[model samples]
Target: MVWIIGFLVVALFVYFAMLGWRGFGLIATGEVAGIGLGVGVILLPIIGVWLVYSTLRAGIEHQQLARAIKDDGRELDISHLPIRPSGRLERDAADELFAQVKAEWEADPEDWRNTYRIARAYDYAGDRTRAREMMKRAVGQYHHVQGR
Candidate 1:
């Protein structure tokens, strides 16, 4: 999985480099197209920086959450989670497992940790939309908790 992630990062970098190269080529023409391409080239790095920042911030936040959970005497044991080799969960089993967590989440909808836990379940179940929605909620609640 680490190798896959590394490969993907390299691939994305190469892809973005190609795009920037093309943009630079267009900009060299010194035409109206140059202005547009120049804008694209500028925006690409800004977006890339934002992406990296967001990913790193999420990692930090997740680590914080794990620490908080541990301090609260809760153990997050995800080893039993039925993830397949395809990076998706076995849907039926995931659904069954998530049902319990869903109940927990429903009981305390305002708890960011619960929200994040449910989001993980949604991700394991391959429900990206719900996972993203839940994660947004979780992040919002976390920010609220932090008085941010």
Candidate 2:
């Protein structure tokens, strides 16, 4: 549990740290602050890291989005597609997001919405079998969704 918390904190720190770098970049611009150059120098490396991470993440998302589009045979904005909100998807859930979700449903699987998001995370991370099981459970539980 402690390890999990620690991991979450570290992940959160990485995200905000990147934002801080970006903010610093905008604030320290020469035209904006005159001292922007000086401040930017101090902040550029951090922001550069942020930019690199962002670029890479975007590329991965694009790749997944393409896969999703191909699988669905329709245009879809992958970024607009919601995930489980773990933010862990930054690295772990790329491939599955690209491959699985866009595909058609199988066999009218059981209701498992409670687990659906988790299954998506697993799917995004490329754990299709586990995701499928979760989906089956979610499908089985479908009646509950309408308070049935």
Candidate 3:
């Protein structure tokens, strides 16, 4: 009967109410659900802190690279983009800049673009083993994004 089914549903929800959720308590469609609100309370601050750290790290590395780039050394000509994405850096007038970029990227694996550049740097410097490792990390990240 409809009444029996309804009662069973309610009972089922009550049995599983302790899993960081209130079960079926907030069932409104098209509106922000209670579970969503609960998740937002926990996830937002963690993500915010992560983003802040990433931004600061990137800024610091950018400044260091810019200073290095201006000095006299073997260098690679790059575009005017203030923040260069990771790639294989060339041996031009700015090789020092490329070396700095490789160091920063090695210290932080979260920068996917820089990972590729660092790998290329090592590859060019005849460190094939390190280059392969960095390339593997980059490939792993790429696969993760694709899966998502």
The runs of at least 3 residues in candidate 2 whose Cα sits more than 4 Å from the true structure, single-residue gaps closed, are 1-112
Task: Sort every candidate by TM-score, greatest first.
Answer: 1, 3, 2
Over 1-148, each residue of candidate 3 has an lDDT whose tens digit, in order, gives 6578567645644443433243233322335776566565445445655665665554455444434434634233445323324554444524565577677786876755566567656665557898777766765564465573
Q: Rate the local accuracy (lDDT) of all candidates.
A: 0.78, 0.54, 0.55
Q: TM-score for all predictions? A: 0.67, 0.27, 0.34
Q: Model 1, range 32-95, lDDT digits (tens) per residue?
A: 9787877788579568857966885776776677677778765446677677788666788788
lDDT of 1 at 104: 92
Candidates sorted by lDDT, best first:
1, 3, 2
lDDT of candidate model 1 versus the reference: 0.78
